[model samples]
Target chain A: MTPSHSGPSDRLEASLAGFDVPAARPPDFPTADVSYAVDDTPIGRMLLACDGSGVLVASLFTPDAAAEEAALQRLAARISPRVLRRPQSLDEARRWLESYLDGGRPGAAPAWALSLATPFQIPVLTTLAARVGYGDRATYGQLASWAGRPQAARAVGTALGGNPLCVVLPCHRVVGASGSLTGYAGGLAAKRYLLELESTSL
Target chain B: MTLPPFQLLVDAHWRDVARLAHALVGPDDGDDVAQQAWLQAWAAYPSLTSATNLRGWLFTVTYRCATDAHRGRGRRPVPVEDPSLAAAERPAVDPPATASDESGVWQIVATLPPRQREAVALRYVADLDHAAIAAALGTSTAMSRRLVSDALGSLRKALS
Candidate 1:
């Protein structure tokens, strides 16, 4: 512990150095359960989560690193007990996301699997995903009607708020009955960006 | 209060875990140990109560995985038949850390008892403080400090 003339510990530190910690690699877990990766886009960082079946969740990342991590962790724990950082696992999701951003319609409707949620939410989300095409907007009430629940506009909003597949499922297209921009999980600004991105198609 | 997500935990200590794995097991086996630790941590993540101890918990998992591989080598059939396993054991081809003055220190430390080597590696290689080291080793802080001190003493003598 004494600061001598560059003693044994210092010598050891100097010599056994340059471990060249490799560029961070996606972790490969024993069984391919759940994997996640972050993609940087014009909007900001997007966190994508997936399982063996298909892409599960996509959300605008929180700026705060710790908070973002916790949010993803909670999602993974609830959705898939085993989660890891494997960007390669999300290759397809990344492709679709990039295409969508580039004003290209996703080459195909993405394969998707939803985590556990309310029964009512499933039909509402499914109808929204199918009907709300890019550059298109639907009122919450209309979405409710499409799902065969004409009086459940508010519930439809609630379901959209908890949407696991935000951009991918087109949740941002849902608006208020008056055509007013409404609440979005990615925030109202992001909603505007998406709407503009689709409308202008530049 | 909700705990920080597993992704954050992995980012924070992944490098440390990787280095510790390399120190305990050689390069090839070290990578395997770290990957296994990530899987195990994810499975056990929900059950974790104190979020503050995430580093310690992860390191503990990494340590266990490394030890398991060590034990496996002694008991199981020589994995040398597998190309990857054979590649892992080939030190001349796969030198992870470059040889230097400190390299001798590791060579010396390798000769010590397992616990002491672990103590030294966690302290020096992983750069964990005594408390974190103790937590990872599943021992009291005092014990961890003593182990590190003893290991250093031995290292100094070996160098002399």
Candidate 2:
């Protein structure tokens, strides 16, 4: 990057002209509470994050390391500050994922943390996790009723839109009121693949 | 008081922190210091009641980290000053030329005291204003200005 100034420090500028700054991220705290691991999956690179409480967040990988680090930095900034790469910490989740990929039921969802951005989202997410079974589907309107807010179909969509626990919470099983698959965090194609994977096994 | 979103805070100040760090610690360690500053900022972000100048606050953290790294380097001496090791330690951008004024200027910068070097680098390489440099150095703007003036005077005398 060119120096912004046209001052008398030409020699000083020349000394630092070619210096490249590495991408900056939030510093790790002494209390390394949040642990994350990136793994290759049938879909793509995925980040699995867990904190002292439990597994809290996951993200689809970006194209390269810098982008991925930036993405994880964002996650760490918002969710928790101490984000460390601990592959062994995610071994159980990885096993569950592998089993699910190999055409087997994931029995029950593991203990994942849910620190939603808003309180209203709790009931909506809980209702989805409880009512939407494997190979089964629910319309947004149905999920709203299950959440005890029958008139909140739109809010239900918003809640699922921000779902951090993607496949584990089965947010992909939620559909439009007309039974059409709606937008998913993992693109529609991945959504279709997940639904098909469940349907065949059922 | 509720703080502005952490993402927004980082987006606004991260580059500035990195630039200042690079000036203080050189390229490699500067990057590491910048990253450490970000992590520290994020960790303390929630407790920030009211930051009138969040960018300056972040830069202050970065400055401390860079200075700590510099102090650590002082304990373990590198052979950069030795002519025998000149070929290995020479920076690629400006090759070592004995008779050039530019080489003389670089040498002058190398010989400057630690605080003077940091103040000069912040002024020239980071292109930071007196106010921002003051915050990073944990000094008043007037003091920062004096430091820069003193550094420039030394450089000019050596060159003349």
TM-scores for all candidates: the values are 0.69, 0.63
What are the Cα lDDT values of the candidates? 0.70, 0.66
lDDT of 1 by residue, B42-77 (tens): 788767767766777777888889889877877222
Local accuracy of candidate 1 as per-residue lDDT tens digits, A129-172: 78988778999999999999999899899998878777888888
Tell me candidate 1's interface RMSD.
4.5
For residues A58-129, what per-residue lDDT tens digits would candidate 2 score against the true structure?
Answer: 644444677567656666556654456666767777778778867897866667766534588778887888
CAPRI-wise, candidate 2 is incorrect
Lowest lDDT block of 10, candidate 1 chain B = B75-84
Off by over 4 Å in 1: A1-27, A59-67, A116-120, A148-152, A196-202, B1-6, B25-54, B68-96, B99-104, B122-149
**Which candidate has the highest lDDT of all?**
1
Share of reference contacts found in each model = 0.24, 0.14
Docking class of 1: acceptable
